[model samples]
Target: MSVTSRTRFVNPRLGTYFGIFVSSLLGLLMLLLIFEELGTAEPLLRWAMLLGPIILYAAIGLSAPTREPIEFFAAGRRVPAGYTGLGIGVAAMGATGIVAITGVFFLIGYDALCLMIGGLAGFVIMTVMLAPFFRKFGSFTVPSYLGRRFESRPVRLLAAGLMAVPALLMLAAELRVGAAAGGWLTGEGQGVVILLMVATFVVTAVLGGMRSLTWAGSAEAIAAVLALLVPVTIVAVMVTNFPLPQLTNGPLLRALMHSEAAQGLPIIDAPALQFALPGEGMAHIAKRFTAPFGAIGPMAFVVTILTVLTGVAASPWLIPRVTMTPGVYETRKSLGWATVYFGLIMLTCAAVAVYMRDFVMDIVKAGVPSSLPEWMQRLVDLGFVAIDSAAPLNYLSFAFDRDSVLLSLPVAAGLPAVFLYFAAAGIVAAALVGVSATASAIGNVIAEDVVNGFSWEPLPRDGRLHVARIAMAGIAVAGGAVALVAPTDPLRLLLWSLALAGSTFFPVLVLSIWWKRMNDFGAIAGMASGFAVAVLTILAGEANILGIDGALASILGLPAGTLGAVLASIATPQPSRSVLELVREIRIPGGEVIYDREMRLLRLKSRERSS
Candidate 1:
C-alpha cells in the first residue's frame, strides 16, 4: 500500500470487536442477575462489576500502542463517523451526565433541563460553526490550530497554558465521580478508589494516545448507554407496564406533581430572577417540583445555558475528535451521530429522574421514615440519603445526595444489588472515557504545541510519541492529586470547566474562523483576559464577594474576552498579507490539510540538513 493508503487503513473488524465487547458485558450482567436470584454473595458481585470492565478496557489500551505519530495523535484520520460520534457523545456525557446530572434532574425537576438544552445546542453550534473548519485545517489539538492560524508560537503557547486549566479541572471532576462510584462498589475509602481510578485513566490514554482513547471510548460509550437504558427500561415496565421510559413517564410526572401538593410543598414567592435559599434540616419543605426556576434563578439559568453552550461548542477535547474523521463531510455526519446518541442518553437521564422521584414518593407516602425500604435504608446508612422519623414524612423529611440517586434507583425499587453494580460500572466507564479524552487533549497541547513550540530542534517521531506519553502521565498525576486532596462537588467542578472554556476559547475560536481580522494579538489577549476574569469571579463567588456561581460566573468573562480581542486586534496592525491568505485558505474545503503540508515541508528540510 502507498504510505497515505497505509495511514488511512482502519480495521474492518472494529465494529465486530466492539459489538462483541458490548454483548459480553450484557451477558455478564445477565449471568450476575441470575446469580442474584439464586442468592449469590454481595461482595463477589461487587468485585466482578468493579473489576470486569476495567480489565477489559485495560486490555484494549495495552494492545493499541502505536509508534506512529499520526496514529497516536489523530487515529490516522480514518475512524468511521459512527465511532467518532460515539466517542464525542461519550465524552460529552461522561459521569456528569450519568451520575451528577441524573441526580440534578431528580433534585431540581424541570430546571435541570437547562443542562440538557445547553449541551445539545452546543453540539449544534459546533457542527455548524467550528467542526468542519477545524477538520479542514486538521491540526490534532486546538492550540496547534490557533497558533498556526495566527503564525505565532507565543499565541500557541498561551493557548496551551489556558487550555490546561479546564482540561485538568474536568479531569478532576470525572475522577471524583469515578471515585464515588468505586467507593460504593467496594465499600472502600474514596482515597483508595481515587488512586485506582487515576491509574486507570492514565493507562488508558498513555498507550496509544488518541488511537487508544477513540476505540476504547467507543466501547465505553456502548457500555454506558446499555447500562443506563436497560435498568431504567426495566423500572419503566415495573412502574407503568411500559417498556419505553422516555415516553411513558408522563403519568409518573403528573403523580409526582400531585404528591408535591399532598406534601404541602409551596410555590416560590420570589421572582424567577431571584435566588432562593435551600431549606434547613432533613424535614424542610422544598419548592413545588414543576415550578420554573425553583432550584436556581432565571439569570443563573440563562447564563448557565449560554456558558455551557459555548463551552461545548469550543470544547478542546471534542474539537480534536472531529479531525479524526475522513474529511469535512464525514466530520459533519459524526456530529449528527453525536446528536442522536446524546439525545437518547439525555432522555434516559430524564427518565431516571422521574422514576427515582416516584420511588422516593413511595417512601414519603408510607409516612414512616424509620421503617424505610431495605434498599433505601442502605443508601441512608451509607450517607447517600438522609431521612427524619417525623410524624408525617413529606418531601422535606428526606434528603438525597445528588450523586447517589441514580445508582440507588435499582435498590430503591427493591431490585437486586447486581443492577446497582451495573449502574456503577457504567458510571466508571463514562468517567474513564471522559478523563482519557481530556487527558489526551492536555498532553497533546503540552507535548506537541507548547513544549515542541519552544524547542529549537524538533524531536523525531518516536521521541515525540514518548514525550506525549510522559506528558500524559504527568497531567494524570496532577489531576489525580486535585481529585484526592480537595475533590469538591462534581457538578461544581464541571461548571468551572464549562465557564472557563466558554470564556477563554469560545469567542476566539469563532472569530478565528469567521473574521479575517483576528490576529495573534487578539488571540493572546482574548484567551488571557477571559481566563483571568473567570478565575476571579469564581473565587469571589465562592468567597461570597459576589452572587456569581456556577455557569453565571462567565457572563462578564466572555464579553470582556471578546472586547479585549477586538480592541487589541484593531489597535495592533492588521495581519500581514501571508497570514490573511492563510485564513482564506483555511476557510475553503476539499484540499490538503494545512498542517499536513507544513509537516511535509519540515520533514523535507530535516532530510536536506541530514544529507
Candidate 2:
C-alpha cells in the first residue's frame, strides 16, 4: 500500500491511458469544430485540429532516450518491430502517395494496382537482398556503411549526393502537400503555410532524430490510417450499408459500373494524363472501370512494377528502419511486420480509390444538381470539375493535380462538416511524416557522410550531435524554400525519388553485398553509368524522348547499371586482402563490434605492455 505500489496499480499501462486521453481530446476538438460551423474563419479551427496530432507526435519524438551518437542516429538500435513497421509503412505511403495512388484508380483503372504491388515488391527485395546485409554490416547511415566497406571516401560522398536528389525533392513535395491542405482548411496562402509547416516539421524532427521517429511514426500511422478509413467507412455505410469497403464494395463497384455505361464522359489515357480532356462531342470509348492497362500498355505495366519495387528497395530513408532494429534477425522479422503494415495501407488505398471513383460517377449519374455538395463547387473553382450551361456539373476531371480526387471526396460525398475537416487534417499529418523523415535522412547523410567525413579535426560527441541538428534544420529550410519557388507534382516527385533510388542505388547495393570481388572501380562504374542512363531516360521520356512514350522508358537503367557493374568488376583488379576479409565478417549477425587495424594494433600493444 506504499505510494509506488499504489501508483503502479492506478496506472497499469501508461500507453493505454495515453491513448484514452488522446482519443478523448480529439473527440472534444471534433465537437468544437462542429459547433463552430455557424459562420467563422474555418482555418482557425483547422489550424487547431491539425496542430493537435502534430504537437503530440513532436512531444513523443522528443521523449526518446537520445543523448549519444548511437541513440541520436539509430535510436540506440533498440526500436521494436511494431513501431518500426508502422513508421516504415507511413513513410512509404507518404501523404502525396495516398492522394496520388488513389487517384490512379479513378483516373485509370486496375492498372493502378501495379504500383501498389510493385511498392510491396520493394520490401520483398529488401528482405532477400539488402535489409539483412545492412543490419549485419551495422552502421548509422547508408553512406557510412558504403564508405567503410568499400574503403572509398568518394563512394560515400557520391552516395550522399545521389540520395539527396530524391530526398530533397520528396521533402519539397510533402511540404507542398501540407501547404495545400493548410491553405484549403485555414484559408491561408500556400506560401505562408509552407513557412509555418516547415517550422512545425523542424520542431517535430529536431527532437531525438531517429529515436523520435520510432514513436512518432506509430501515432502518425494512426492519424493517416483514420484519414483514409473515416471517409471510406462513411461512404461504404451510406451506399452499401457496410462499414468495410474492401469486403462490401461490390454494390458500390456495380453502381459505378452502371453509371459509366450511361455517360459519354471523356476517356483519360491515365499514365501520362494531366486533365481529363473535355473533348468536343467525341464518342467516349466505353472503357471498363476494371479495364487492364488504362493508359499505359503491357510493356509499361511491367516496367512500372519493376521500377516501383526497385525504387522502394533503394529508398535511403526506408533502409534505416532495418538498421535501427536491435539485431539482424529482428531486422528480418521486422520486415515481415512492416510488410503487413504496408499491406494495410495498400489495401486501404485500393479500397478507397474504387470508392472515390464510385462516389464521383454516382453523383453524375443521379443528375441531381441540388444534391451536388459545396465541395463540388470548390472543385469547380479549383478547375477540377468543369461546368456546362445545360448540366449541373458539365464534367469532373483531373487538371494536372491528381490530389483533387481525394480533396474533393469529402465534399463530393457530403460528409459532416467536422468529418471533412478531420479528413484534411489527417492528410496533412500523413504528409508531415513523409517530409520529416525525408528531411532527417537528407540531414543525416550530410552530417554523417559529407561533414563527418572531414577527419582534419575529429569532432567531439557534442559537436557531432550539433552538426546533425544544424544539418536537419538546413535541409528542412532548403526543402521549404524549394516548395515556395518551384513546387513539383506530388506523384511525379515521388516517382522520381523511387526511380532514382532504384536505378542508382539498387544495383550498386545488390552487387556490393552479394559479390565479393566487386572492386571500387566496378561499384563506381555501375552507379555512375547506370544513374546517368536512368536520369537521362527519365528526362528524355519527360521530354517525349524521340517522341517515344509508355513502358519503354523503364527497362534501360537497372540492367545497364547491373551490366556495367559486372563487366567493370571483371576488368578491375581484386580488392586488398583486408577489404576481402572485412566483407566476410559483414555477412555475420551479432551485437559485438569487429575491430579494425587501428583498434587491433592498440589492443596488441596493450597486451604486450601487460605481459
Candidate 3:
C-alpha cells in the first residue's frame, strides 16, 4: 500500500489512539483501587477517578490552535452523524436521570414503570414533531433561529438568557451528584469533594473546549452503556429466576397484603403490578412512585422538553456532525444509528430501576446502620434504607437517604474508576455542548442582531472565535458556582431547568417557526408570561406544577406559554412588512444556503476587490 493508504489504515490520529489507551489504563487503575478499598471507598475513589478524562481532554485542547475556536467549540462543523446522535443521548443521560430512576424504583416497587412509559412517550413526541424541524432549520443556536424568524433582536436575547439559566441549574445539579458520590466513596466531607470536582470540571472544560469534548463524550457514552449493562443484565437474570409475580404471591407479599387489607385496601393485585390502583397497594405505590406535582411538575416538564428540543434543534454541537458529512442522507443514516445506541442505554437505565425496586426492602433490612446520623436514621424510618439491600452495593444506602443513595450509585458500585471515567467524559460532553450553544447564540446576537442593527464594524471569524472562548470560560465558572450553591436534589434541579425552558422559549420557538402571524410583540409577551408563571410556581413550592408530576411538567407547561403568546399576538398589531418577509425567508427549506452565502459575501466585501 502507498504511504497515504497505510496512514489511513493505521488511523494516524494520535489523539484517538491516545484517548483509548488512557481510558483503559484509568479503568484498570480504578478497578485495582476498588478492590483495595472495598466496603469503604465511598468518596475518595470517586474524586480520583474524575482526573483521567479531564487530563485527556485538556491535553487535546491545549495541543490545538486557538484561531478556529468555532471548530473547537462546534467540532469544526465536521462531526460524524453517529457521534452527534450518541453525544445527544449521553448528554441527556446525566446524573439526575440515573439517580432519579433508581430512587423511584426503590420507593414504588414496580409501579414506576408507568412513569418510564410516560417519559418514552415524550421522547417519541420529540423525535416525530420536533427533530425534523430542527434538522431542517440548521442554525447554530435556538435563539438565532428565533431572531431570524421573528426579526426581533430583543426576543433572541431574552431566549438566550432564559436558556442559560436552566442550563446552568442542570449543570449545577449534575456536579452536586458527582460530589456526593465522591463523599460516599471516600467517607469524607462533601464540601471538599464537591469543591474539587467543581474546580476540576471548570478547568478541564475551559481548557479542552468543544473538539476535545466531542471525542470524550463518545467514549464516555460507550463506557457508561457497558457498565450499566453489566449490572442490569445480572439483575435481569436474577429477576428471571425470581419473577415479580411469583414473589408477590409468596409469604412476604401475602403478609403485607393481609395486614394492609384490614385498613380497607388490598396490597397484591395482579394488574397493580403494571399500573397504579386504589387501596393499600395503591397507597404504597403512590407514596413511592408519585411526586408532588403542584405547579412545578407541569412547568418543569414542559420547559425541559422545549429546552431540549430547542437545544437539539439549533445547537452547534450537532451542527458540526451534519456539516462533516457531504449529504443530508448520510446525516440521517448517522442519526438512525445514534438513536439506536441511545435507546439501548435508556433501556438499560429502566431495567436497572426495576431491578433495584425488586430488592430494595431486603437491602435496607440488612444494611441499615445503628450508628447512622440523625437525618439518615429518619430516612431509614421512612423506607430509604431499602435501597442499600436492593443493589449489590449498599454503602450509600447504609449512610444516606434514598435520594442521596440514588445519587451515589456510580460510586456505590465499587467501580470508582469506571464512574470517574464516565464523569470526566460526561463533564466534557456537557461543557462542550453547553458552550457551543452559548457561543453560537452569542455569535448570532452579535453578527445578525447587534452589529447588523447598528451597522457597526462586523467581527471577523478570528475575533468571533476569541469572543466564544471567553464566553465558554465564563460559562464554565458560572456552571461550577451554581453547582456549589444549588440544592442536592438532582430531580429538583432538572425540574427547574425544564420548567424555565418550557415557559420561556418553547412556546415562542414553536410559534415563530410554524405561525406566520407570530409577531415580535406576541413572542415577547408569551416568553415573559411563561417565565413569570414558572418562577411563581417554583417559588410557591409547586415544583411539579401539575398532577402528572415533574416528569410531565415540561409537556404541560407548553400550553401556558403558548397561550400567553397567542393571546398577546392577537392583542398586538401584526408585525411590520419587513418582519413578515423575514419569516418567509426562514420558512423556506435549505434556508442555510442563504445564510452561508450572506456570510461569504460579507467576508468578501470586507477584503480587497482587486484580482
Candidate 4:
C-alpha cells in the first residue's frame, strides 16, 4: 500500500476529529446540566444531550462507504491498528461491566479487582495465542474460520448457535444500560430510553454496517476514557490533594476508612455490621479486606481468569477486527494498543470503585438524602439514590444502587454537573458500541455462514447488505424487547456469555490452528461437548436443581472441549492431504487468490501438490 492509499484506507483522521467534537459537545451538555442544577434546564436541551450523541454517532456510521461486501463485513480490511485496538477495548467493556465492576469493587470489596486482573489477562491471551494466525487465514469471523477449517456446515451451524445466546443477551442488556443511562438524563423509564438507543442501532447498521461501526466504536472509546478519567482525577485532587487516583488513592483510602459520623446511630447486630460501616478493610471489620479474590474462592478465581482468556479469544466481533487490519504486524501491534487501552479503563474503574465506595459511604454516614443536594434528590426520584428516614441503622442502611455508580459518580461526588453529562454520554456510547458490534457480528454470521452456505449460489453483494441490515435490525428490536425485563446485573449476564463463548469456540480455534490433524468430526465433537456441558450446567444451576454456581462454570466446559476434540480426532478419520496443504499455506502468510474464477485452479494445484 502506497502512502496515499494507506492514509485513505487505513489511517483515518477521525481520532483527532472525535476528540474535538466530543469536547465541544460535552461542554454544551455540561452547560445544560449546570442550568438544570439551577432549575433552568430546557426540555429540548436535555433531550438533545440524551439523544444527540447517538444521532451523531449514527451519522458517522452512515458516512462510511459500504457499497461493497468487504466494506459491510470487514470494513474493507483497512482499519489502522490504533483504531482497531481502541474499538476492541471499548467493545469488550459493556455498560454492566463499567458500572457493576466499579460498584462491586467499592460496594463489596476486592473481588472486583479479580475481574480487573482477569480482564487485562484476556487481551494478552488473544494477542499471543490467537491474533496473528487468524488474520493470515483471512476470514472475517471465528465462525467463518471454523466453517472453512473444518469443511463442515454442521460445525459452523454449531458455532453460530452458540454465538446467538450471548450476542442477543448482551445486546439486550446493553440496550437496557443505555436506557438506564438515558434515564439519568431524561428521567424516563428503561423501556422508553431503549427506543432511542434501538433506533440508533437500526439507522447505523442499515447505513454502512461494520465500516461505520469501526469508526463509531473508536469514537466511543475516546468518549469513555475522557468521561472516566476527568472525574476520577478531579475526585483525587479534591480528596487527596492530588490528581492521579491510581497513584494517590492510598491516603484517600485511609481517610475514607477513618472518616466517621458526627452523630451515632443505634445498632442491631446483623450478620455483617449494617449500622456505621467500620470500613470493610479497616481494623474493626471481619478479616482484613486485603483479600485478593473476594467472595469467590481461589479455585473459582483461577477458573474465572481462564474463562476470560478463552472468551477473549473466542470473541467473534473482536476477531473480525484482527482480520481487517493491514497485516500481521499491524494486528499484533493493535493488540498492544488494546491491552494498554483496556488497562487504562480497568485501572480507572478500580480507582473509581474504591473512590466511589468511600464517596457513597461517607455521604450515607453524613445524613444522606435529607442533607444531600438537589442532584441527590433527582437521583432519589430515579431510584438510584434512596434514603429511609425510618431505617434502624440511622442512614447506614440507606440504599445506594451499585449499577448506578458510573452514571451517578459525578453527581454523588458533588463535582461539576457537566461531568454528569459527559459520563451519561460516555455510558450511552459504550453501551451502543458494544451492542452494535455484537449485532453486526450476528448479522454477518447469519448472512455468510448460514445463508450463503446454503447454496454455492453466491449471495448477491447487494443481497448480503440487505440481509445483514435486516438481521441486525431484528436483533436490535428483539434485544430491546427482552431488555424490558433483562437482569439488572449486566456483569452476571456478561459472565455467562463469556463462559459460553470460551467453552465452545476457543478450544476449537486453538486446536485447528496448532494441530492440523484435527478433522471435522473432532471439531464437531469438541464444540458439542463443550457447549452442552457449559449450557446444561448453567441451566441446571439457574433452575435450582443443581448446586452449581456461575463463578467457574466455564471451567467445567474447557476440559470437555479439549478432551472431546482430541479423543474424537483419534477415533475419526484423519483430514485429507489437500485440506492439510491448504492449512499449511494458511499457517504461512501471502497466498494471493489471483482471480475470482481462479480459486478452483489454486485448489487443484494444492491437491496435485498434495498427491
- TM-score of each model, paired residue for residue: 0.95, 0.87, 0.70, 0.87
Best TM-score goes to which candidate? 1
TM-score of 3: 0.70
Q: Lowest lDDT 10-mer window, candidate 2?
A: 275-284
Which model, 2 or 3, shows the larger lDDT? 2
Question: Mind giving the per-residue lDDT tens digits that candidate 1 earns over 284-389?
Answer: 3356667888777787778778888988889998899998898888889999999888888888888888888888788778887566778777877767778777
Instruction: For candidate 2, write residues 1-611 as lDDT tens digits.
Output: 65332112222353784586459546855665566776555656677777777677777666664667777787777776656767777787588777677666656667677778887888888888898888777666677777777788888888888788878768877888878877777788988878877776666657577777656766766787777777778887887887887678666677666666566453445554222211211112224566665566566667778888988887888897676766677788777887887777777777776776665675566566776657666767754555443555423432323565665666667776566677777778788788777888888888878896743122566777888889998988999888888645666777767777777788888888889998888778787877777778778766875443322334687888888888998998998898887878777765354322333565567679889
TM-score of candidate 4 relative to the true fold: 0.87
lDDT of each: 0.82, 0.70, 0.49, 0.71
Q: How many clashes in each candidate? A: 1, 2, 35, 0
Local accuracy of candidate 4 as per-residue lDDT tens digits, 566-588: 99999989998866876776676
Instruction: Candidate 4: list runs displaced more than 4 Å.
Output: 1-8, 30-39, 256-289, 360-382, 387-396, 455-457, 485-488, 589-611
Q: Which has the greatest lDDT?
A: 1
Please identify model 1 stretches exceeding 4 Å from their true place: 1-8, 269-285, 368-372, 455-458
Q: Which residue ranges in model 2 land beyond 4 Å of their true spot?
A: 1-25, 33-41, 264-287, 368-384, 389-401, 454-458, 548-554, 591-611
- Tens digits of per-residue lDDT, candidate 3, 222-271, equal 54444445444433444464433212223444433333233332233222
User: Is candidate 2 or 3 superior in TM-score?
Assistant: 2
C-alpha lDDT of residue 519 in model 2: 80
